[model samples]
Target: HLVLILCMFLYINSVLLFTLRSKSVFCETSRYILLYNLLFADTVYLISSSLLYLLAAFRIKLTFYMCSVVILPPVLVYSVSPLTLTVMSLERFVAICYPLRHAVIITIRSTGVAITLVWLSSSLNIIIRVLMLLCSNTEFSFDLQMKDFCSEEALFRVPMYYYFVTAYSGIVFLSAGVTIICSYIGVTLVARSASTNKASARKASQTLLLHLFQLGLILISTFHSNIITAAATIMERSHVLRLHSLSFIFLNILPRCLSTFIYGFRDQTIRPFLIQHLCCQLK
Candidate 1:
């Protein structure tokens, strides 16, 4: 059942990704380009994460190196969603608030540069985490089979490493939340302007709100481990197992699938094209 759900969402994301690149308009626009980056990152994360989940479910204990290979990429890509979202919010803000300069500020070349920076920054953080994990683990070895279940928590055994992750997650989400909120406020103020296009402004405002909701889902997915741990303390073992499975679905799978609906259904331009492609694929 779980595999079925993951595959279904993966198929939807794959279709939406293809739809975005199917036309020149989607390729040329700054917002769609950013959406492509976001969807691509989310898709990668979903694949890696689902793989890890299946590994754990089957009780397949991986070696230290194998665990890192399976888990670290998801961690790296995890940061990309929020960061890409921040960029997307800023793009919308510019489009509505500064309509005249939106073109000059957010070009195709600049969007490419922005995406490059996002990946570079995320890679740097993961590299640092791995280096620090190595330095801290005196007995760490490539051949070491994991004693616990394979997850991020299994790799981050040291106190400082966990602390560093907590701090980094806080900083990333804090900055992202603030940027999205500020962008929403800016759009709202612009909507009140006498000369602003009321319909466009309203749509942009709703989009920004959806971004916030999506960010919130991403935020929940990140802290799901903590939530499960806390709940296990009070619940029976059987209940905890059930709760864990539920968390994996709602927190992990559902959040990643939402980007498709939020943009695919909401954007009129993409809606018809996405529907046509989906129907053709169904047939």
Candidate 2:
């Protein structure tokens, strides 16, 4: 929890420094808003899910009350994050390809509506899962002999809950994968055509890099899902532990560490702004 808190603090400070120091050269309000939303989503994950893990690592038992309090935010944030990325990709595509109608189409009101929809959709996943858990008569009993975090056998003992979890996982993965693929193809096509102009090409390249970074993150998440499924299927302790650790490092820790490098430092505008911000802070 402390590590995650420190990382989050560093992230916020870096972003603040960059935003404050940067000259108002580009008035890309939509992009700025998207970045802000991404940061907020990550913050939610850091506070909720990451904290839970940290507490567990320190042999701290989170009270049922605390678990209840911490659970929803991370689940909702993670659920909505991919959707937000998809929306941002679409917004970028429209801005790049249809510059004339970009202003009319991607208005502040429309952006707000889109963000709300993403949040709503993401929240529904957790809500439905929680509802299923609540309605089920089956109680979760931890088996000390099992050597697993939670037993799938115990969960599947309730057939309805099993089906609900399966459906939820499928929907989330499929939705994220489809959006990512569509965005990649759309962005690639637009980028190819706009390659003639150096400035346009540069912007296109940056956008592609951003998309790639996001896609990598999603792919890591998908792999984590597969690892979990495999663990559940085989019930092997070693495999479960290994996969769980890898998933945590890649999905949680690495993404937070790499986000600034991929999103901010790689961009021409953001890099200078970050440097200026750091220098100013030092002075």
Among these predicted structures, which one has the highest TM-score? 1
* Cα misplacement distance, residue 230 of candidate 2 (Å): 6.2
lDDT of 1: 0.90
Each candidate: what lDDT? 0.90, 0.62
Give the per-residue lDDT digits (tens) of candidate 1, residues 146-256. 898789888877778877888888998999999999999999999999999999999999988988988898898878888889998999989988888889988888877
Which residue runs of candidate 1 sit more than 4 Å off their true CA positions?
Answer: 281-283
Worst 10 residues of 2 by lDDT: 143-152
Q: Which residue ranges in model 2 land beyond 4 Å of their true spot?
A: 1-28, 138-159, 194-198, 209-213, 222-246, 256-258, 278-280
- Candidate 2 residue pairs in backbone clash: none
lDDT per residue, candidate 2, 1-283, as tens digits?
Answer: 5465557556654564357335554334666566667666766675565666665456554433345556667667775666766777778667766778989999878888888888888778777766665566445432222232222232223557667656766776567667656755665676667343446645655665665576567546645656677787887777776777667767765554454555566666667667666566564
RMSD of 2: 5.1
Q: What is the lDDT of residue 166 in candidate 2?
A: 62
Among all windows of ten consecutive residues in candidate 1, which has the lowest summed lDDT?
274-283
